[model samples]
Target: MRSTLMDIAREAGVSTATVDRVLNNREGVRERTRQAVLETARKLGYVTPPDEEGGNANAPVRLDFVLPAGTNTFIANLLDQLVTQAGAQDGMDVHVHSIEGFNPDSLARQLDALTGTTQGVGVLALDHPTVREAMRKLAASGVPIVTLVSDILHVPRLGYVGIDNRAAGRLAGYLLGRLLGKGAKRKIALFAGSLSYRGHEEREMGFRHVIAEEFQDLEVVELREIRDDRQRAFEETAALLKRHPDLSGIYNIGAGNAGIGQALQEAGFAQSVIFVGHELTERTKRFLLDGTMDAVIDQNPRVEAREALAMLKNTVLGRRFDYHPPRLQVIFRENIPEF
Candidate 1:
């Protein structure tokens, strides 16, 4: 059994109030009594939790950061940046977690469990109704949630910390059109981690809108959902290419770059296909350097880490701060950043 203040008081022959003062180091009791109480607490293993002056301060802020599990280099890099930020920020006590694939049911359950104990949360959640409801309950209790890489619509939140994915998709469409440049009738296919993600869906919408209005010759097939698995991506990509030999381009708004690269190479279409994908990971960087990929849409993870931690700190501290959207960086073979 663990010890309590009353137990410490009983063992030391002192009042609970004196024990409280001594535990808080508030100063009032005589030095002899203070020393005795301290020694008793030490012997009893009574750890003093930091005082809640502003609720999550005197110590680090306890935040639950939930991500999806996979070899998605973009997410992996983002996770590393966040872990570094957690170590650097004395105000941020982040506990990182990962759920398998695009399972919103599990994500919702985890969100519900984080209430009442953790001060805040960060997530790359599916835009599902149950997940939103769970977030609503937590928000009602003043537990701030900041959605990273994706945003849930019509729900209260600290803020969304990512690029305008719609704009990215539109740019992707334009880039594809420019690369193919008045080529013979073209067919393009789009891939996604999952349309359940608002970011990926928005990207799809923007891609479709641009292809329809600006590039009529570029025809897009229905979206292929990979669930961010490399094997799934490899199989689906191989099947799609075999099914459509005339496929001119591909835009994977999600991830699994290695799978995409492998399928393209094995199918003997890496040189012929016009590819545009998101994020600047080592795999994608190699593709760009080797001329396997044409362009990459990168969201700067360092800036994201700094902004996300700041947003969580302000929200927990109840301070008003301006929210600015991070810029979307486009990389070409000629301008790849140092690996």
Candidate 2:
């Protein structure tokens, strides 16, 4: 006896109408829910109709995700979530690539190489001429592009899937400024992964703007080109502390939280200097508890990865959908949720 859509829906724990939509390749079904229905249909030995392109309906759509090469906990979390979520989806074939040293030429070459290979691309792009040219060319070649985590200007991409970085930076600045408590002329150190990344640059701009407008007593001293390297962050932080022992606060526009925390602890300024950074990883959580970090601005990588994939696939399939930007969460020790 042949199985029915009702049977598949029952097994998939979704409504029969949703199973019908999935089997018919109709719009309005979510990517994961659609995949779940499809998996159930396959398990029940139900044959689905051919897709619009007249290919195997079950064949996956190939997409690539390009991220920076680093051990940054947030990036690592994004990579992991990309893999895990794509694995759960039936129609997404996601390939993740890391750009070495955040090199523009290398990233451009990578984009050029992927021209004919992938149906879509989601890149954490740098705001460089070569990289922008590559992205424009790729978009011109009929492949859809989506910017993930970071965005580039004047690019013909499908959409951006990440938090509002400028707002997040302002929030960080506000937390640090208020925590320092009506400072009577205090210094705050700002670190960035690199200004080349549009996200980081926007964060720096917002942080500086808030400090200048609201907290006139606080002076922001920045050390350039940290590159999100732990050792470099540690060294620069140690030297900065030695030069200005009265550094009242520290705000990292990017990663290297652990290194900054280590430097503060070693200098015996962990409790004195209010530290705020990005990402709510295990280490950052520990820092929040131990008073090494005062606040962390976090975005859910799982939501980002899933959104990126959905945007890519929907564009390739010419499906119209609404996009919601991911929300940013400000976490402290008091409100840190269990993973």
Candidate 3:
């Protein structure tokens, strides 16, 4: 059996109250006494208990979450769900901080600042060398990390809880190709978010691969580095429509479905074009319902948030978790649940 606070107090030749003060880092506990208590606790492998109900605990675990800042509905909803779930957990407090954009230097600075104060971190970070180095530093500080949505390749993270972007992209490609009719020569326009995002990059790659391998008649014109800006997307879509009047399909590997849908509507090509995109946000859901968006590759943000919190608790509390395959759900217009 693992040791308890009482065992730690007895072994350290201190009272339970003193041990509590030391463990919780409360003031008035002598340095020497605190060291004794900590040493005893470490030697005996004493795990802290979960916080009790209806009372503030002596010590609470603090977790920091780093994400990208945007008015993007999907990300906002995901954060809201994560905050709700974290608030419900006993003794677990989550503080969310976001960088203005997917800038590695800014994200690295944020990670560096959290090294000592945070017990754990959940990141939706850009896949860059500097960000990876920061994650390594956090890991070295004995802070566990859980990655959300986007992944950091080869970093020793606790776990990743999100959709398989490549697979989802392939699904979108398949839907578009089939809807456009196999062997029908058609020009398809692809609008992507920043390629710095691993998820977006992977989705674009999968989309291209599927179009090349499965739908040879379909040619993809990729618009590069179009951040999820609605106005920009509208302008870009209008330009693409004007440039390629023969365009028969559109694929959005990122957010901004509303802008794309509006452009298609204004061009009077909504029913004629095969459109596919990611996420089922309020705007996208409405588009799908109105027959503007052909399909949406839905990654359930609620489920992702729930699993992330569960994984974080497991990691921090040293609880064992069974190996389960990554959870990725595909939501279509017919299957989209009412919120």
Best by TM-score: 2
Give the TM-score (vs. native) of candidate 2: 0.84
* Candidate 1, pairs of clashing residues: none
Off-target runs (Cα >4 Å) in candidate 2 are 1-55
> Where is the poorest 10-residue window by lDDT in model 1?
47-56
Among all windows of ten consecutive residues in candidate 2, which has the lowest summed lDDT? 45-54
lDDT of each: 0.83, 0.84, 0.79
Q: Across residues 1-339, which tens digit of lDDT does each residue of candidate 1 receive?
A: 445557778999999678756654555899999889878876775543234344434676788888998888778888888899889867677788888758888998888888877877888999999899998877665566789998887776767899999999999999999888885678999999999999999999998899888899988874799988889999999999989998999999899777988899998999999889989988888999887899999998877777787777765553445566679988998998885
Candidate 1 Cα errors over 4 Å, as ranges: 1-57
For 1-339, candidate 2 gives per-residue lDDT tens digits of 545555777899998668656654669999999878877766666653335345655778899988888868889899999999889978888899998747999999999999878888999988999999999888766567889888887986777899888998899889988999794888998999999999999998889889888999998765556788888889889998999898899999998998889999999999999999999999999999999999999998878987888877775654545676789898988999988
Q: How does model 3 fare in lDDT?
A: 0.79
> Which regions of candidate 3 fall more than 4 Å away from where they truly are?
1-58, 323-326
> What TM-score do all the candidates reach, one by one?
0.82, 0.84, 0.82
Question: Model 3 reaches what TM-score against the true structure?
Answer: 0.82
The pairs that clash in candidate 2 are none
Task: Give the lDDT of residue 190 in candidate 2.
Answer: 91
Which structure is stronger by TM-score: 1 or 2?
2
